[model samples]
Structures are given as structure tokens and as C-alpha cells.
Target: MPAQPSPAQSAQTQLERGNGPEPSTLDAHRCQEVACGNVLRDLYEGLVTEDAQGRLVPGMAQRWTVSADGRTWRFVLRPGLRWSNGEALDAGQIVASFRRAFAPATAAPFGELFDALDQAQAVQAGRVAPERLGVSAPDPRTVEFRLNRSASLPALLTLPIAFPVYLPAVRRHGAQHTRPGQLVSNGAYTLAAWTPQANLQLRRNPRFHDAAAVAIERVRFHVTEDAAAELQRFAAGDLHITEVVPPQPLVSLRRRFGAQLRLSPYLGAFWLGLNTTRAPFRDAPCAAGATRCDDRALALRRALAMAVDRDKLTRYVTGLGETPAYGTVPPGIAGYTPAQAAWSDLPQAQREAHARALYRYAGYSARNPLTLELRYNTSTPHRRLALAVAAMWRQTLGVQVRLRNEEWKVFVQNRKQRAITQAFRGGWIGDLADARNFLAAFGNDGPLNWTGYDDAGYRERLARADAAATDAARNAWLRAAEQRLLNDHAAIPLYFYTSKHLVSERVRGFQPNALDRHASRWLSLSP
Candidate 1:
């Protein structure tokens, strides 16, 4: 283990991340939540990773080439690689990790990513053996992969799922593989300490291939959700970095912090999703003898969506540089154009009136109002949004809404298991700068499709878009597909995201990107 820095020295190197990442579980393969992703990125190096500018950069796989058919991808591993435990990190270990991801026993949360590999479907379904999956290693330093389709795989591998797993540790310790003593990381940093729902501290990994390039000696990420409280901590100098910035003090913080107060566009959408499998929210008529179950539920969805004043949500509530979102995918992603819902064209009054009419026609009134629960993770902004939107639904359409919130970790678990019974908050940060990354999640059996929206026609549009020969043609198909989705109101698009954070002046190499990703390894402190 590396020697610990003194209290005075640690103060200069330590970074305080106010309540964003929750270290619920450290096993990256089993954990899909961003909290775990943040920890894993610090602990492990993937075959590929996005640079500070959000471009593809080499990680474990130093360089790669594609076959003439574009279906076979080969990569060369960096020689003399060693894990934090001093174990060799070679192509064989990489192949084994990928096989584990595809095997039926491991319920890999991002296992959907493997579906792109050849024979992955059969391997995942238990039809074909796991060893038959399309990963091979001819030598310790060479890794080869055969893809089922033609796509730029390096970009996909940038996701956390593609990060190499230290198999020696995992094979020895099953569930507790990532515990402090058991874990072996090859990244710039390794887990030094984790006090759940409190703080996670990371120390520089001495065995990292390029540890000399790393600047920050230690990073302490603190769990903080309240924007106001985090701002206070930032002001007190107790926190060197925090993403939670209060909207009320934006103008003042700009004056005080100046360049340190960072506000940039985020390539993400904050929306609300209605569970399509549950009773009133179901996509088809329930067997409970209600004839208007399906049609009326859809009408109710559109009515609720139409009643929202997106402009107001973006203006007063968000108060950052966010925009009203009528579509799922945000603009600026490659091959994407904004798509608007039918109600977007109507005047505010007319939109509300139409919503009211739909509400009444769907057999919902203040006397017998359609009651539903809206769930969100613990955050002040979410509470404010839910309250404001609930007020709108009541005033515009006489719909009754109840707001519920839980810690982010528990909420994510429930959401993934389809335990959320009604509408829940959902925000998607693009894994890569592609429209397909956002729109592909809604197709039939799409991994990110939490709404349970399954329409053959909509799925066909996505398929056509995926199969299109040209970017323009694919974008057209995607636009039509988005229009259909918004028209059906599968999920209500509330607003786009704006990354707001505070970085101390002492911190260097903090380039602001749309993805808002700043790896601790890239950061250094000025003496």
C-alpha cells in the first residue's frame, strides 16, 4: 500500500465531491448505476476511454485495427501491464472477463452491450457455451474480437462495461471482490477507503502503467445531494470540487468564484417515465374489464405531457443553461435533429385547454381525478420539479399526483428491477455522442426502455434507422421514430441538462466538456 499523506498535505491533494456518486457496490459488471461507474473508472482501466474532450482514447488496448469485412476487430494490448496487486494484465484475463460478462450466470447489467458481439445472443441465452463467445487471444499481448455487425466498436468499448476485470481477485472472492484489501486496479487511482453514503477516498495506484503522468495523490468524493448545502461547503473551502450548485445563488457565485463556477451544456435529457406494465399506465387494455384502459391511459399520458410548461421549467426551476426538451435525444449529438411533440406548436392556453378536454374525455375529473404517484431520487431540484409539475397537472387538467423520493441507490435498484409502479424520474447522459445512443433505448426489448413501450411499428423505424446506408437517411428515420414516441407520450420530456460545478483555482487540467467528465488522474494542484 502507498504511504498516506499528512493531514496538511492531504488537504492540498484531496478533492471533495459533494453527494453525487454512491458507492453501493464496487463490482462494475453487476453494477450499472453511475455512482458505481464513477468508482470503477477510478479503479480500473477499460480497453478504451473518452478523453477530456470526449473523444476516443486508448486505455488497456493501446491500438486496434479492423478487418476488411469490418466484422472482425483486433486490438493490441500494452506490454508489461500490471494490476495494483502486481498480477499480469494480459489478453487472456481480458478474454476471460468478457466471457464472464456474456455467460448466463452473471447478470451483467450492461450485458446488452455484448449483444453486438458474434454468438453473444446464444451464449447469453444458454443455447451456446460461454467459451464460444466471440473473444479470443492468440497471444498474451494480443486480443481479437468478432462482431455480429459493422459498427465502430472502440466507441462502444469506452463504456464502463468494457473495462477489464481483475480476474484473480474476482475468482478468489466472489461478491466481495471490490473490497479495499481484495481489489486490484490498473488505473491511475485505487480505492483507499469507502464509507457508504458518506465518502469514498482514492489513492494513487503505484502499479498504474502511466502513474508518473498522474498528478492528484488522493481524491475524496463526499456524498452530497443538497445544492444549497454543497454550495456552503464549497464556500467554506471544505470542498474543493462539487457539482451541486444552487440556482438561487448562480449570479452571486459567478461574481465570487468567477472561472471556478463552471456551467456548461450537458448531453443529457431529464424526463419522466411511466411504467407501461402497470395497471392504468399499461400500453394495452387490462383484463380487468375496463374498455378504455389502454386508449384512455394513452390520452391521460398525452394530457399530462401537454400540460407541462417546459419553458417555465427550464427558466425558473432549472435556472441554468438548460432548454425545454420535447424529444429524448438532445441536439448536437451526431445525426440528430430536435423533434417536438404535437402540443409544442399550440399556445400555452390552448395546450392546457386541450389537456383538460382529454382528461375529461378519458373519464378523469376533479370529482374522480386520475391519481398517480411520481417518484424521483433524493435531490432538491427533483423535488421542486415534481411539485411544480404536479401543480400544473392539477391546475390544467384536475389530475391528482403524489410525489415520492428515495435515495439514488435504492431508486436505481427498484427501477432496474421494474419495481417502480408508476411514473419515475429518468435522465440519460449520452454514453457517446450519437443519436442512436439515445433513441435506440426505446426499441423493442431495448435495454434502457424502462417504460415497457413495445410497438412493432416503432421498433421497425429504429431497425430501419440502424440499417440505413447514409447518415441523412438514418436521421430521417430517427426523427419519425422520435415523433411517434413523443406523440404517444411514452415518457414526458421535461428539460435538457446543464452541468454546474465548482472547481478550485488550485486544480489544473480541468477542461470543460459537454459530457462533464473530468478524470482525477488528469488533475493536478498548483503549489
Candidate 2:
């Protein structure tokens, strides 16, 4: 638990944060967006949580132990635990939450996080009942997990998918259980009020186990998707922290705010996901009497990937100290080295020439341009990036590019369905500091596998990685799997992400970490 706040810290307890679009739902099980996860972090506590430095710490579980084989873990809950509604919270409830998250009816988007658990895959596929999951509550305060193989389970527990839910409220309200008045949270804060497109308010949870250490009594998350508008709000003193800093006015912002401007390496990747199940990208027969019998779809995808100049995109468009990425997983992950594209080392002129040749081989030329749509969510940065990429495609490969922007909810839905999507903007932020968190998403049956990427060899390598007995063995298999994905051109890795925010000088305890998670409970405002 954090130390108790001083008298001065308690005086100005109200905090206003400029945030992105309104979360589609507060239900942790169904959430897939980073913005939604931010709110969920405050409303629920899993078996483990992260501190200001993003280090894993005890949450609901005060202490835990792992077996010699490393396939079984037991956690002992904190004493006198109670929900925000004043109901007793025990190990049984935690077990129930795990079952609910894996249940087929729930359709949890991030359910892949639990794939290491014994029988978790079978339970999610409806081959077995949810009760057959590896989690069991042996006693009122003791919960145990049985895994089929060894994994970083403690770090995985810090994710929202492992957080417990109030079963009684869920039963009574169904999907509406997360509403302000009905939500029964177990974290440092509770939902007080929510106005769509405006703000979502939370108050300190009096029944929280560490309430004495919570500094902020009230927190208001103001929905402002546009970075320019968020910056205005922050400058007007209506916001203590801006969700993102617009790339256009970054120079001015740095000059004005100086030390208040926060920029840190974020463990995420921004990329273009080609719908491998749809036209223009799906595996198709090569042209008749072609010199090479390679898959034309693969050639087209690779051509598009090679045409983009990622260095220019990062230095000019984003301009926020982001690293140009040639692979799915970002750098700096412990025990792993990321894989790069085969053509990553080619000179720009030579790369463009090679892309043109591949484009022609794919049966598209200046006379017959390959027309396609690029879809992205509405955001200033997204629009600029999309436009730049479209221009690059048109210039390098004689492709007709169409840009389509949709709201957050609609864009996510269309991208997930993949019936009409051609090439869409996609990204993933690591739930833990493991390369598996990024590589596993491309698995054939992965919930986050939006690209329809399915390869028998790739899946086999991932399976071997998961069952490996040592870190070296696991990372070797993981690296081989990533290399296969990059060679196949499943997705175009644009650049690694860097979190850019403008935090007021008055906000204390706002530490920058690789995960970019800053909960209001650990923050206080100076008057």
C-alpha cells in the first residue's frame, strides 16, 4: 500500500483529467481499448497490481507461492476485504470472476491472456464447462490456479481480465452492472456519475482496503478525443493531465509547458493490419504464366510494407521521440530480441524499386491501379499518418488509396468483423513486459488476431514456446515465430509508440513507466 497522504495533499482532492473518447463499456471482460483499461484499473483490483513504477505488487492477494514445478500457484487474500457496496469479498468471488471471463457467453476479447491456465482454451471453446477452468477456491481467503505449463502468471494477473467482478450485481443487471449506481468495485475508487461524451466521475471508495493511502477523493475523466481540444483544456486549467499531445503544436507545447510535458517509451506498436481473409490481401493464385508461382496476395502486402518510409513517419509526422519499428514487439523487453523485416536494411531507392517490381508482379500497374480503402479511427494523428501512407503508396506503386475515418466504437466493430475492411490501422500495447504478449496475438485462434493470420508452422512454434521449460527455449521459439510472421507480411509494422502527455506541475506522484499507467489513487494535487 502507498503511504498516507499529508494534510496539504488532502486539501485539493478533486482532479480533472483530459482523456480520449468515451469508453464503449466499463465491463473489464469486454474491453479492448487502452482508454477503457485506464478506467477499469481504478475500479477493480486483481490478484496483483502495479505500483507507480509499474512493478507488480500485491493487490487482493497479500502473499502468494508457486510450486516446484511452477505450474501451480496459490494466493492468500488480504484480511477483512470488502467490496465498495460493503459486501464481503472472498476467494470464491475471485474464482467466479475467472470463470465468467472465460465463459463463451462472455466473449471476453482479451481471453487469450489466460491461455496458459489448465483447460482454459477448452473451457473458452465450449468443449468444457467454465467450472472446469483451472481456478479453484480452497478456502474463503485462498485461491489457487493450476496451469498446464509454466508462464509469468504473476505479471499476467496484473491485467484487467484477471480482476474480480461483483457476481451479485452482474446477475441482477446483466450488461448494465457497470453503471454508476450499480457498479460494485473493489479498488481504491467507485463510480459516482457518468455522462456520455462529457465526463465520467469517480469517488474514493471508503470500503477500499487501502483507502487511508488514497490521496485523490474525486476524479473526473473528461472525454476529449481530439488532441488539439485536449491541449486547449489543459492550457485553460480545466484539466490537470492531457490524454495526448498533438504532433502539430509539439514544439510550442514543449516551449510553453517545459517540464510539465511528459514523454516516455510506451510498450506498444502501431501498424497496418491487412485483412488476410478479404480481397487484395487474401491468398490468391499467381498470374497465368507468371515467372514466379508465389502467392500474389503476399507480394502485394510486402510491396505495401516496403514502400512506406518509417523513418520519415516517426521524425516528421509523429515527432514525439517514437522509434521506427520493423517488428511487432517493441525493444527493451527482457529475455527477448524482436525480429525485423527481411528488406529492412535495403536503401530507400532500392527498396522503392523492389516494391515496384513486386507491385507489378501482383498484377497492378500504372494502367490498372489497385484500388483499396485504408480505414482508421478519427484522430488528428491517425489522419495525418494515414494520409502520409496513402501518398507513399500512390507514388511508389500506382495504387489508388481511399481513407475512411470512423468513431471509436464503429471502427473497432468493423475492424473486428473483417467483412468489409481492406487495410485498417491496428496496434497492441503489451499487457505485460513479455514478447509473448505481442506475438501470441497473431495465433490462429487468438482473440486479438484481427488479421486472420493462420499458419500451421507458426502455431506449432508458439505451442513449443509456451511449453518450453526455460526462458532461452521459450524466447528461441518466440523469435522463430515472429520471423515467420514478418516474412509472410501479416501486418505492416509502422513504428513503436511513445506516450505523450501534458501533466500539470501541481500533480504529484505521476511517475512515467513503460506501461504508461497512472492511477488517480496514487496521485495528489498541490494547492
Which numbered prediction scores highest in TM-score against the true structure? 2
lDDT values for all models: 0.80, 0.90
Worst 10 residues of 2 by lDDT: 4-13
lDDT per residue as tens, model 1, 200-275: 8888899998899987888888887776778888889888888667766467667888999888888888899988
lDDT accuracy of residue 370 in candidate 1: 85
Alpha-carbon TM-score of each model against the true structure: 0.94, 0.96
- Number of residue pairs clashing in candidate 2, backbone atoms closer than 3 angstroms, sequence gap of 3 or more or interchain: 0
TM-score of 1: 0.94
Which parts of model 1 are misplaced by more than 4 Å?
1-4, 19-21, 286-294
Ten-residue stretch with the least lDDT total in model 1:
285-294
Q: What is the C-alpha RMSD of each candidate to the true structure, in Å?
A: 2.5, 3.5
